[model samples]
Target chain A: MDLNLTILGCHSATPRANAFPTSQYLEINNRHFLIDCGEGTQRQMRKYKIGFSKINHIFISHLHGDHFFGLIGLISTFGILNREKPLHIYGPKGIKEVTILQLKLSKSWTKYDIIFHELSSKESEVIFEDEKVTVKTIPLDHRVYTNGFLFTEKPKLKKLHIEKIKQYDEIEKCDYNNLKSGKDFKLSSGEIIPNNQLTLEPDTPKSFAFCSDTSYKPDIVPIIKDVDVLYHEATFLKDREDLCEKTKHSTAEQAASIADQANAGKLIIGHYSSRYKDIAEFKKEAETVFSNVELAEAGKRYSINSYPIEILN
Target chain B: MDLNLTILGCHSATPRANAFPTSQYLEINNRHFLIDCGEGTQRQMRKYKIGFSKINHIFISHLHGDHFFGLIGLISTFGILNREKPLHIYGPKGIKEVTILQLKLSKSWTKYDIIFHELSSKESEVIFEDEKVTVKTIPLDHRVYTNGFLFTEKPKLKKLHIEKIKQYDEIEKCDYNNLKSGKDFKLSSGEIIPNNQLTLEPDTPKSFAFCSDTSYKPDIVPIIKDVDVLYHEATFLKDREDLCEKTKHSTAEQAASIADQANAGKLIIGHYSSRYKDIAEFKKEAETVFSNVELAEAGKRYSINSYPIEILN
Candidate 1:
């Protein structure tokens, strides 16, 4: 399992010279996905060396400017770059209308086709699927209609125990694929070799969940249970818990509580309000609730496949 | 006369690390105006220490994404900051529709009013005027419906010659405002002191013209003649003069030709295409025809009021 996540911008409310809004780049199973592009996301992508052509799919959490304001700009740049492939965008309803209107007014209709998938479902359902990965939506409670995305790698085919298979002469090279498919090996002597004994179990698939700008919603834990990595919004600390309810945000303690309830392997918390002077306090408070916690910083990359969660700045 | 210009972003197409798109902060006669906000204009404003509240008016040159993609983000930030004063936006006919659509979809309606002044004129016309400054649209030839802007400070009140007034005690302090209005003072003896003799002529009013994303339209020389400063888009050098016609852009030599014909005090050329390796070439080529030329660089401030044109990094 190989998965890498880059935090582009994580600050909340407004963008400052030092503080950017929420945007991230995720790479899993050699597939690239951009989540929640804020105002400076493209610059951040350039800073982080994320190629523009690598991304064919973009997932927007909601219609908030902090989450998706850079979509139109990025799309226009693709036109300037002469991208020929069609781009797919998934977001809340009305996304296509707003995007198309800007394009029409600018008279910058891209030669490349734009495929929009507007999601209005309230229930958690799979929205994207391929041979390698599947993406599901985790409906969240927020001021606006929003959804968190869960990305999971599909299960791998069974691996054959080459040394054990060599012991049986009946197991020819032509039957290797069938044996790898977890079928029992039948011999001409009317004897049967169990599939489990002939093949060892493959490595477990990895999963990542991204949730942001939502209040304390316990129901999401069930949808993202046992996720290898969970990135949640922690806009404030426990001291400002009272503001969380009104703002429809979550505190660091609340984010960690959700991570603990879901038994996530690791938790990354971000979307800090600009009012906070220190982000270390978020980590200190979240650690008390969940043992494994990491603070999301701009330009930081987290690799959960490595033991102890390898982080690169 | 005090006029300061800050180059926020002056690149032609997409924004790069060091090259911004097209955005400038102009301070003329104590009025702040933002011109052509590209994708990262707000961040550049923060870098240049331009206060968000200081800007009351924003002017867009055209509907190109690089020219005005940052408008929605800046407007949304104003909402998050709880700005109470109404924001005035001046641009093309579709500016209001595109901006309002984004705000509406975000559900982040601002408490402050957004006064949009949409322009659809093909001739030079005054769009905004107050006591100190006047802004007029300079129609340009572009691929789309585009317009340049000319900002000029109104002629100031005449200065009161204290020494000359002391020579004639009949010129009472109460009559000072009347004299400042360029009115001749009438003595009780029926002898009139000529207005020019009573007050020295005030410093010549300063003017700045912003022309971008346009081809060589020499017809505008009469409209902006004797302008103190001219900021023109030189997207290509003389070597790529062929592209200017097809792309509806101007070369360095063409920009210099316009400045020379208009008799501008200073010529600032920007909006350089990314293909050029060095921006110094723009200044070199422009200076061949125009004596005083400056290359636009991000974070540089040019003050034309001072001798030799004060440039601060």
Candidate 2:
């Protein structure tokens, strides 16, 4: 399974020249999941060559315009292009009303089915699960009802047993399928064959966590602990600590501090202020606390394998 | 007065790699006015080096996502930048609701005052005006309640009478300013200098009309008649006439026919379909009917002066 995450947008409430708002595309087990579609996100996705047809599920962290403004456009484009596949969207309660109102006003109703999962309260709820992965929610502290998402790969199956299977002529033929199915079987040689003898250990399950537009809170630590990749909002620098406090946002140092406390394998910071001409200051500030700090630039990709996260800068 | 029009986005509903959606920057008399802010419009404005601070008024044709998706992000950016100037927006009735709902959900209120003039009917009405130009709506046939805008320049002041101002002490001392201001004076010879003697005729006012997302309709001719430049949507080629009719859009030949009927001096076609690989087909199709046909490409500029419209291809 190739687990890759592409950063479509990395800015905060404000959009800058070269940077986009908050949006990301996660690919795992040949399935595409979109997280936080901000304004101009579809164009960014088009620029990055992400196929629109591949995106079936969308998870929105909150109702901030930077997180979901592009949803309407992407939805409308899907309608214009006459898509027939259903699109599943999970977000806060107000998202349905906003999306519905736009469609009603424009009289541009979609042809495909759109299933909306409106989340209202804070809970560690299991939202989605497939054969390869399971997703949950991590509560976040923000001015609004914000939450983060935790995607954890499911554990691999146990290996099969191979020894002592050739001794039986009648029983071995009958129970050979059971041995290959990772079951301990009684052979004709009067020996018990363990299920772990045939195959090696399965690969480790990789995980990714997305935390958006929130203040520094330690509550999410347990839910996102030791994740392979963690994307946290770093809206301001250390110098603008007062502004960060005033706006209920986190500075780069604070985001890095949370990543350190959560014991995250890699820390990816985004949602920068437009005032900063160069973002080197943010990486420098975060690297003081976290060793593996990657600035989440728009259009950049970060890969999370079983080994370690590598950034395509 | 400096009158320059920059095509920020030129493609129609279907998006392409290089061409953008429908958006244009109209610069006249040192003021910038944006027409139809499509998706990725802010980035397009930046690419053309149009100062965002100079834009004061925004006119939206309809509630289509491609026409106004970038508006919320642009407004949010203005708030983040702490802009003090007010932004005036003119659109259909639903626009205000959409904008206000997004702001409420994000919990991010704008710092500057925003004025919305919502249009409810298809009647032509003046939406914005300054010293040099006025913007009025020209209703058209579309799938939605869409309308086009006609930007006509106000007539220039009469030229100064420089010849008869040789002896008047108070008026002649001020040079050409006195004559252009239409100030009259009595000469030392006991004869009044008439205003008509030393002045030639003032030049004609230059105008530009923008018609977006409209089908073939001859009724729009009177509203945009005799304009210096006309930008009409040519969403399809001549071969796809039935598709244009079914989709409620216009083909290149239909757009050229409208320009011919309106007697516009220059015809600039845009809002192209993404299906066409080469845009030369559009120009060729339109030029067969209208001689002065030009294709509107992104980053292209059309300068409007007393002379003919000059396109910087």
| Strongest candidate by TM-score | 1
lDDT of 1 by residue, B1-313 (tens): 3899999999988876677799999999999999999988999998889999999999998999899989999999888888999999999999999888888888889999999999998989999999999999999999889999999999999999898899998888899999999999888999988998889888778999999989999999999999989999999998988999889999999999999999999999999999999889999999999999998888989886766678888
Instruction: Choose the strongest candidate by DockQ.
Output: 1
Q: Tell me the deviation in Å of residue B57 in model 1.
A: 1.0
Off by over 4 Å in 2: A159-182, A186-191, B14-16, B161-164, B167-170, B173-178, B181-185
Residue B303 local lDDT, model 2: 83
Model 2 over residues A208-238: C-alpha lDDT tens digits? 8999878888788888888888889998998
Question: Candidate 1's residue-wise lDDT over A1-313, tens digit each?
Answer: 3789999999997778888889999998878999999987888888889999999999999999999988898899899899999999999999999899899988889999999999999999898999889999999888899999999988977899999998998789999888777899888998999998889897578889999989999999999999999999999998888899888999999999999999999999999998899999999999999999999999999876767778888
Off by over 4 Å in 1: A160-179, A184-199, B167-172, B187-192
Q: Which of the numbered candidates is closest to the native, going by highest lDDT?
A: 1
| TM-scores, chain B, all models | 0.95, 0.94
Listed for each candidate, the true contacts retained, as a fraction, are 0.80, 0.66
Per-residue error for A72 in candidate 1, Å, reads: 0.4
Across all models, the iRMS values in order are 1.0, 1.8
lDDT value, residue B1 of candidate 2: 54
TM-score, B chain, candidate 2?
0.94
